[model samples]
Target: MEFFNNHTKLFTAAALLFIGLTIFVCIVPALKNQSENAPLPNAIALSDEAILGKAVYISNGCVACHTQQVRNVDMDKVWGSRPSIAADYAANYRTDFWRNTATVMGTERTGPDLTAIGQRQPSAEWHLPHLFNPRIVVKESVMPAYPWLFEITNKVKKGDVVVNVPVEFLHGQKGKVIATADALHLLAYLQSLKQTKLPEGIPEPNFLYKKSGDIGEKTAGGPKELDGKVLYITHCQTCHQSNGEGLKGAFPSLKGSKIVLDENAELFVNVIMNGYSGRVAEGYGVMPAVGTNSNLKPEEVAAIMNHEKTNWGNSAKKVTTEQVKKWMDAVKK
Candidate 1:
């Protein structure tokens, strides 16, 4: 009994030490994080109305549907941005905001992340309609409308204000006006979601390229010499990339491309000068008209086209100035 009594104080001290260390490891870093990045929340400070909308978001169980964080690997690859850092959670970490009180750092992502919501859809008119009735904007969205939130917001009796109501607003069955403050504050919060900065330490993907064909097309009937590499690097490498892989859905691949191999080399020259944008199996979404640049001379466009066709295993006939000029005339017509 005397030995047990003697060791009780030592055991108590050890227990207290463990508790203190645990608290320091978890809470102290969170506190330091709050101090270091607290201003980020203020970057999109919640106004009184925004605070109310937040409450509405909470009350409507939106947290059950949407998530705020974007995980690193998944987000960076496809979303063009990275996940949230300590800076993103500075406000919730420090103060007793709705997130802190409800402990609602939601898990499910029934909808896309709200972290980059601002950049995803920047138009204020679009947001107004989406909130009133999501289906009007997204044909398949299953979210319910908050028609009760609507109230006649503006009244100008002297002169009828030409208010442009968005098509989505017409979804409210009862022709009721909306609370502008609610909509505006929601927009402010959404606008704050634009974070285009990519993740640290990750590099953007690159495009592809192919080799040039035989060079005996000149009158010499021998390998003709042209600084095709220098010409292409200077003029076309920026968008097409040296390897010719092309940006997703944007740029077309020139490596082993059918267009480069076409016997109708005149069509190739014309496109280089004028640019064609109907469609290619693999291409960037749109093709800008080369002549539209106004600065590229017809000869320069021809040189770039010749360089691409010759270098890319596409042993088609070389492009001539006459072919380029003819295509230019056709484009003007």
Candidate 2:
């Protein structure tokens, strides 16, 4: 009571209490984190251009819609190889005095998670047009276009980076789409968002609540099927479409296609792994090397092939994983 009656004593006691808490709660954890977490071994530092792009990403409020973190859940396995760890963001610090931290690990995911978007979709060809107008690639996409990031010009300068957008989405403009510096920068940043592989021998965190009898390859004991439908949607559906009827004058329809129906399976595998630029004369843009970029396994390729062969009313011969591996190895050679 006597100590409380002294105003100075009371004030000093409260200040000391808060100071102790500041050290224990905030400062202690930060110090511990410095020792506990470090950037992944294979993780590359962001380029100067990517840094600028990160600023653009932040300014455009992309953080509001996209998430950078992949949670430890079975559903999020599609987003990343593994759940995000503290070390994943160890390098994400404030770029400058004026800017906030670049660790925009957002909470909400209105759009797909971008934890490993760099690996999933590495094509500048796809990203540029998609950025110009999401509807250009995905007909039912709800994302708004950022047309301001591009320039429509008939005279493409030597150094100008052209965006390969479809003609219809160009509003009949007589000019090639050029990517501005900002757009390229943003792409660099987006491309830099690949999750680093964990060091070998260190156990990765398992996803919780994984369903029993999940799809995978048939091994020695039993058959575990990989979901070809999921793989198709994740990688190819945007360009080829869910119905296999690709965009007219853009992506070639996979339905009843000669390459798909052929028993050889050479061209189909080649196109998926190395991409198809031969269709440029037929008014289609270059298909990205999805198989290579996604690091798809032989079993995954077989699953996608089987899915395409069966879906969209096409009754082609189902390809086996062993068959796919043979062609995949041949192509690499």
Candidate 3:
């Protein structure tokens, strides 16, 4: 009764209760979230160039179509090795007084998710041309080209980064397409989008609700034969078209290539495993090490090779997993 009569005492008690409630409700949970969602040990901090690229990414509204998140579903597995986790986005948060930027986990995904793009497509050669014109690499791509990020220069300087665009895609421009600072920064950011690996012994989160037909099955007469058409679409269709006709002067066509028709697959295996880095000098963008990047099994390689050999009227000898394994082992220098 005495405390109620004293207004100051009553207000003091109410203030203490408010503070206690805030500590219990807000502060404690925030601290727990911070501890549990700590950045992964394998997480790499963004480079200076990547930071600037992120700013460019934001300004261009790239988040509108492309998502950084890989949802926990079997269909999303193609975008990442594992399901998206809280720690995966821990590094994307930057809390400070002047600037507070949260993760760019976009809401809608018109384009494919970019969570593991760095691991999937690790070639600047592919990226540069793709940015210049999405149709150059992916014919049906709806993504807009960022041509403003490049400069057409008569003479590429000593340290200039050249973007190898198809001559047909250049639209009568004769000068070399050089990557400006913004383009280089954007490439750096895209290359840094690799998903962090889980710690050793920690069980990776399973992609829930897998479809029955998602896996390869054994044939009635032979061993398991994965759908090579599906594999080609997933790994190669963007650069090498569905018809096996890659763009002229950019990506070489595999339709009638000697490498595809060769009886001996030594050179073919080497090209897939290590990539043809020398292709840039030959006026084509370099091929990426798809086998290394995607962790392609011997069976997978055989399937792709067989698809390339048989399709587009090539009629080359179909490869087997055992043959591919032997050839792969031989070419591993």
Candidate 4:
């Protein structure tokens, strides 16, 4: 009895110490890991204007509606790629104690997730219009317009003292002007959509076509030529004719679509895999889903995209499998 009573206090003190250490081990790492695994902000290679735009994004409560993280649930599958990790965030993020980074990511999904949005839509012009008036790009968009982002000025570059307007705003009438900061910063942030590698392997989204000089002589028995023709006829012919004359009013004529003719060919592959729907031309309906075509292989898509450009009146730039693979990579925002 004497021994037990005398040691009771000492034993209790040791017990408490053990419990505290156990709790620290469990909790401290979790908190540290959260930030360690946090994604880096995929900031774009910003210019003076884009840097200022980043300030705008932080000031406005845009993060309230949009989330920068892509969870591993069904959402990632729907959007492509998997949930982001701390390494994915890279050096783009601005850090702080509260970690306001993506804390405001609401669960409502009122707007599309902004995780890899820059990869989905890389056009600066499109983003500018969409921000000024979401209705221009997304007719169904319920988002309010940021008219304050617009600014009007006669400021002209020293080189060519002609065009006062650097870009056309979405809702701006002839006289009104919008701030370009929103466009630049938002684009910088959007362009930061580069994620890690695919789980399986790197996807092939060949944006460029190869030439004989680029890859030596063409293969003899390879399906390069025939496969290209077949895929285009089977899939593309519905919208773009066998002769490459896309339907006049409905489909865009591929005869000279900048996307098709660009020397950088992977753009076509990304458009195909992602399935473009925006108004590349005015009044056109959303593009149909095509990457889901079971019969179409990544190689075949690359071939057709190349053949279409070079065939008919189009120039023949040989596309390789490698180029398509690169385009399939998570686009660097």
Candidate 5:
């Protein structure tokens, strides 16, 4: 009681108690957890470019909109194959004394979870323009554009990586768009954000949830007529506009495209199936392997073909799933 009456002694005692509690409750537990969650021997380190890109991501405040974590819930299945675990972030460490930040693990998700964005949207073709203007790809997207990371030039200059921007999105800029080195680095970082495969015994995605069924499921009467508009919006519309008129130099217009109007569907099928890289259209960036990446089914491919052909004044006959399957089989052979 006498000791408590002395304000100085009481203050000293309280400070000691708080310090001891902090050490035991916070510091000790954190140290023990760090030891337990040590990075796996095979954990990959970020490349110099990727590290720079990570800094760009942090500086740009991307964490404010997107979350790096995938929670352990059925709804989060769309974000990643499995819920994130402590070991997943084990490799995230301080590169040096000055830079101690790692593993952003954002709280809010104004945009989608980016934990598996590398696997989900890996194409530089898609990412570049999307970064420039999210509305270019996702019309409904509210993500602010990062146009400063790119430049408009009349001449592409050899070796310069050009971004495919539709004329409408260019805001009257009469020139080709090129991504800056910082943009490339940021893209590399985004592509490197694939979820690390967890060790065995971790909870995997619950496949029981039938939110949207399989990519392409058939009904009794052949494959159900998939909503071509919906499919296009989900996959193709980002590069090619809803009107079938693609961005001027970035993506080729599907409306008057020879490929879309061709009598034989081989070219269309092959482009969708394997992907087109050669100079099919002059001055256009490479088209990522959407069919392979998205694992689009035969019926789904047929539906897209039919939609593109018929819409935008194309007036071409609808393609059947059997036709797409035959072409796919021939390609495999």
Candidate 6:
């Protein structure tokens, strides 16, 4: 009764007990887990350039918009092959003991997940311009341009890496836009963000959502039949737009494009399957291999070609799946 009446003693005891429990229950267990767990066998340490670029990424507040972790969910399959495990991040070091420095497994996803961005969008040709002016590549992109990371010079040195900025995006700049070393470093870091493969004992990826057909297989008039409108919306609308009028300086318009109206579909099919860089054109940027990336089928390609040919006040012959398949086979050869 006397001890209970002592408020000062009671408070001191409670404080000490709480502190002790926190150390034993939280701190000790965490330290133990960290110590016991080894980095995944295949986890590669970041190169010096990538490490520096990581600093740049952190300083630029990129972590606020992009996430590194891929969750175990159906929707997450678009970002990575499988859910990220803790061992994936074991090689990442903390900036300091008190703060979580390097492990930037962000919570918000203002941008796409970067767990496997290296594999997904590896081309420096795409990323450099995107960093310079995201809208130049993706007309609807809301990402801010990091133009400061680049310099416009009339005379590009022999060894300097040049960014192929479209004339419209250049805004009347005379010289070539050169990527700074920092930009290269940042690119290296971004390219280093590939998802490490799990070890033998780990379970294989279990995707929740499964599509029925193979890459080039689809039924005629069935639900699996290539919906040209849907395909255009999902893949093409971002750059080419719903009206088929592509962004002027970034992407070429498809509404009345010569390539789209051409009698022979070889070039068009090749462009979709392989990708195209229109650097010689004053206001055109690179087009990624949409068909390859989306795993589009020959029927889907034919459907898209037909839709584009007929839409936006254009009249042309519908492309057939057989034609697309023939072109694909030729390309492979």
* Order by TM-score, highest first: 3, 2, 5, 6, 4, 1
lDDT-superior candidate, 4 or 5? 5
Give the TM-scores of the predictions, in the order they appear: 0.45, 0.79, 0.81, 0.47, 0.74, 0.68
User: Could you give candidate 3's per-residue lDDT for residues 51-92 as a string of tens digits?
Assistant: 999888888899999999888898887788888899987766
**Count of backbone clashes, every candidate in sequence:** 17, 2, 0, 30, 2, 0
Report the lDDT tens digits of candidate 5 across residue range 59-129: 89999999999887756766776778777788887757797667889989999888878866676777898
* lDDT of every predicted structure (CA atoms): 0.55, 0.86, 0.86, 0.57, 0.81, 0.80
Which candidate, 1 or 5, has the higher lDDT?
5
Model 6 over residues 1-333: C-alpha lDDT tens digits?
876899999999999999999999999997887898779888888999998899889888899999999887766766776878878887888756785666999989998899888756666766788899988667778888999999999888889988878788888778899999989999999989888878888786676666655333346764455668776776677667778986655567898888899989899998888877764366565676777655667888887888899999989888888899998777652
lDDT of 1 by residue, 59-89 (tens): 6677887777656653222222445555555
Minimum summed lDDT over a 10-residue window in model 4 is located at 160-169
lDDT of 4 by residue, 86-182 (tens): 5554345443566545333445566767665545445454555556666554545788877566654455334321212223432344543444545
lDDT of 2 by residue, 153-256 (tens): 98999999887776878887879889999999999988888889999998999889987865666667867879899889888998888899887766789999
Kindly provide the TM-score of model 4 when superposed on the true structure, using C-alpha atoms: 0.47
Model 3 alpha-carbon drift over 4 Å, by segment: 1-28, 95-98, 172-174, 214-225, 248-250, 270-286, 295-299, 325-333
Candidate 5: stretches off by over 4 Å = 3-44, 70-87, 95-100, 136-139, 150-181, 195-204, 212-224, 258-270, 322-333
| Per-residue lDDT of 221 in model 3 | 94
Off by over 4 Å in 6: 1-22, 96-99, 209-223, 228-333
Query: What's the lDDT of the predicted structure labeled candidate 6?
Result: 0.80
